[model samples]
Target: MASICLGRQPILDRNHNLVAFELLFRQEETEETAHVTSDLSASANVIVNAYGKFGIHNVLGHQRGFINADPDLILSDIISLLPSKHIVLEVKESASITLEFLQRCKELKQKGYQFALDNIVAINSQVELLLPLVSVVKIDVLALTRNQLTQLVNQLNHWPVLLLALKVENQEQEAHCRQLGFQMFQGYYFAKPEVMSIKRADPGKIPLLKLLALVMQDNDQNSDIDEIEKEFKHQPGLSYNLLRMVNSGSDGLPLKINSIKQAVQLMGRKQLQKWIQLLLYTSSQSADSLSDEITQTAVTRGKLMELIARAERPHDKNHHERAYMVGILSLLDQLLGIEMQQIVNKLGISDDMNQALLNRQGRLGQALKLIEAKEKGETASIPSLLSELDFLSLNELSDIETQVRGWTDHTDATVN
Candidate 1:
């Protein structure tokens, strides 16, 4: 099957709750923004991969998904295939506001499908006509100044449609949008850390860090397992969760594990290491917390990095393991609210992994850079990064991404 690369960005409500995701069609392998020659074909691919290959529940869970819709898609029968209740079709701003376009939107609205006017910079006759039909209006916040944004918000206040601030890049922008009465927001602001020098890693997480370091160490003596088991004993909750995860394995364990040692033995060091990394996200907080999205993002990154490494090295298990570690650890600073350098220092990871995590250097570092670029929608830089890793083509990266997304979605569902 041809690989599909889909990029997703979280959309938060006024309360900063993850209420939806803006699913973007990415064409990282090609020179054009979309591999398909036409926008209709591009939209078709996104809908198929999201709702078919990945499944809606895996992609959006219980939250709604905001998908881009050009005029062609908006007026087509294919749009009806999307579940009306779970989807919010975003009408592209560049779409011509003809009478037929407006009529089609009204038809979709009557069928229980919601529409959002995408990247609205100013209120005009076209926007006014569609306001009543759309349930949401996504304003291009980055395109306007503070005064312009406030003025636009006030103008939009005349309508019943909810205002969504698009391209929000920082907390300050989000606050401004909230003050301006934007009900929904889409951006990378949530993932970016507000670093504080005084912030330290949670004391409870220190042991998990040590356990991670020990597992990644070169020493394979039985003493290593004893030390790991000892650490888990010190944290009974971690031990119990480990056992639970093993028992609940999709491929059922051949033997029941009665002790931490047994669980460790059954899972082996590699799998145990991954579980401990995952526990770093779940053990400290509820699954419904705001950090849930961040945890999911980290897991996705880790899996993508691992797949890329597998494709590149093919035979180097250690390199693949480190790639996964780099991807997961890349976001630790955001999760822990501490400087990444400090976390790396504490983990005592190898120098290559350290460079990858802290500076985005080395082979693994370039892979991390590619993932970051993909997340930020910097598709222009992707081709060059792919060039650096000549062994793996863009099609391979797309395939790897599709596989990683599926794995991460499954892992998130299982972990929760």
Candidate 2:
């Protein structure tokens, strides 16, 4: 019953936001035969060669995706799997971008495919030669020195290639890279994906459970709106959580609800009860007794972030799931005060999401790290994270931050 999750990745729009997203995805490939440690790769050739629609519809369609492949894999399957007009093909650094590969890439470009050079650098002669063919260039910033970096920055400014500063270790590096003009970034400084364990009675779920209990204890299928408000007010955070959830969506409600009573009226009692119970069981809070505020905060953050991710990536991709996973994971310790891996074990999250959560060695992990950094008020690292997610406009980024903060404030006030 493993479920694919967003992990701790940051979900960005054309602007970067602390969005809720399905940053990671997976198949129940645990045949015990599907090695737990296989070298991951992109199979673009499967797309081109395949007659029908690319299978990327369900698999590898997470908010942030990573695929690694050697020359042979790309030369053979990658060309086919590449949907050209959509999706990205990241050529592994292990491959030599010989003229032949470049020629093939050129042909693909003519057909509308986009390409990225993974872990690129100065000595990566093949990438340098094919710079014109690439849409994005990811550099392992950890390995580059100030001087080497200077050369790349100076040389790339004139190119159309988007520079991704990968493995940016800290806020200082993020700042320096922004000053040097890198487009996106990745690193450990962003929130590290953590695996936590939680129990049903854990304090994390107290608020949610309390709300649930109160609602259930007064089992009137049609409780008065004021009574419902009283229930939420009894707990410190419930009203705010409702406001945050409603406001998070694209069809922003016309009137802002400042209290739980209004929210109860807005959503009939039946709907409110169902959602509250659902929120209680969601990954946001442990399956324990709940507080009004913590429970509502988890729900508010998860729903709000998900709305942001879904809006930015309107396609059928699982961006919402990614966004929610990160939002919940970010607040897990605060709500539960438990170790992370334990949480993963208790939940039904799939292996790939676990990789992003536990290892932070992949693409989704990097994105999550970025979101964590921004949320912590580290503005300098914003650029690098955006680069990792892709090119982002400052205005969109601002909107996202504003939305999250607004939701946070709204949720707090309503709940308090």
Candidate 3:
């Protein structure tokens, strides 16, 4: 998944716990514009312009969105183009702290638009001029240690400007930042970031991929099962796994599955491929011979949320697919040594699915993160997050383990 300007961890008090995150959003691609004007005046398009639609839409309903802008945009009439009060105008680091930029910032602040100074460091820079003008001063965490951060916090401690620590990477860093009195946190340490190179292959996949390639061929919209498996006469192991999955009681098949034909006839295309993928994980690579239970946790969570959406709202969605994708991909960064998008494209996922995983752009991404937080047992913040999602509690979400446990069990059982 590509990192769209997705969501971020909220700025925390020195406690290293979440207070509320800086929510990132994707600019919806709509041809016709409403709140923003056709004329691009001051801000030369150095940064990708997010359509103020997310802000406007939030405005109509009273929500908040943060939009980053340059000094040029501040000087132009563009600040007026913002939809409503629910926006935080982030003054980019590249922008000058000129009298004009400061004056416009003061004007926006007067109009209820919060200003954030991006990548601020060393209170002495032009930041000294703009500090009194902005509400939040965001510092990149990578550049500071506990000592330097402590010094900065002590210095900025008296100022009303909030100290936001952005891009925190691990528990130690998080804890250190908390000790240093940072008010916000953001980074990739929460979910496993996908790695580009997993040194070993799933030993089970070599054989399994070959079999799956067989099954995938029949999936051609035109071909029948018998016609597809017609050429493979010597595949016994493939014959057995399909039979086990078909007879695995979950399918409720009337008779036992002995051949690929029986599996094709009874289980159908969709279910069979799922079993094959799960079984393949039985090999040593990702599963580490562990059960699919770990991955299933994510899948079940995704599916349950999807079900909640469907019953509550009524929509035809690949909620289950999205769920499985999240569960499996949570470990992707480990296997691939890269970001989620690198592997997400290898799978069949929808735009919303991609949005949630890579960019944290959709409803599902919010749901997934909520589940993750709950699982970690961050007692106080989860409910507040739930409040944002407009959901009651973990009562419904608690059912996720039931959905995903079996997959984990399959791989675990094999290892044992």
> What's the TM-score of every candidate structure?
0.45, 0.36, 0.37
- Badly placed stretches (over 4 Å) of model 2 are 1-15, 18-66, 93-96, 191-416
- lDDT values for all models: 0.71, 0.49, 0.50
Per residue, candidate 1 scores C-alpha lDDT tens digits across 213-328 of 77877776588888888988987656655655454332322245678887788777866775566446643332223344565577678778888999888999989878987887
Q: What is the per-residue lDDT of model 3 for residues 142-253, given as tens digits with 9 covering 90 to 100? A: 8976677777778877779877777777888778777776666656654321111112222243454454555544255436566535532445544543444344323122
Who is ahead in lDDT, 2 or 3?
3
lDDT of residue 347 for candidate 2: 45
Residue 14 displacement (Å), model 3: 6.9
RMSD value for candidate 2: 22.5
Question: Considering lDDT, where higher is better, how would the candidates rank from best to worst?
Answer: 1, 3, 2
Model 2, 23-117: lDDT tens digits are 22222222111211212211221221111111232223333333443343343322443334334566754333455556666877777776677
Backbone clash count, each prediction separately: 0, 57, 22
Worst 10 residues of 2 by lDDT: 45-54
For lDDT, candidate 1 versus 3, the one ahead is 1
Model 1 scores worst on lDDT over the 10 consecutive residues at: 192-201
- In the order shown, the candidates' Cα RMSDs to the true structure are 17.7, 22.5, 24.0
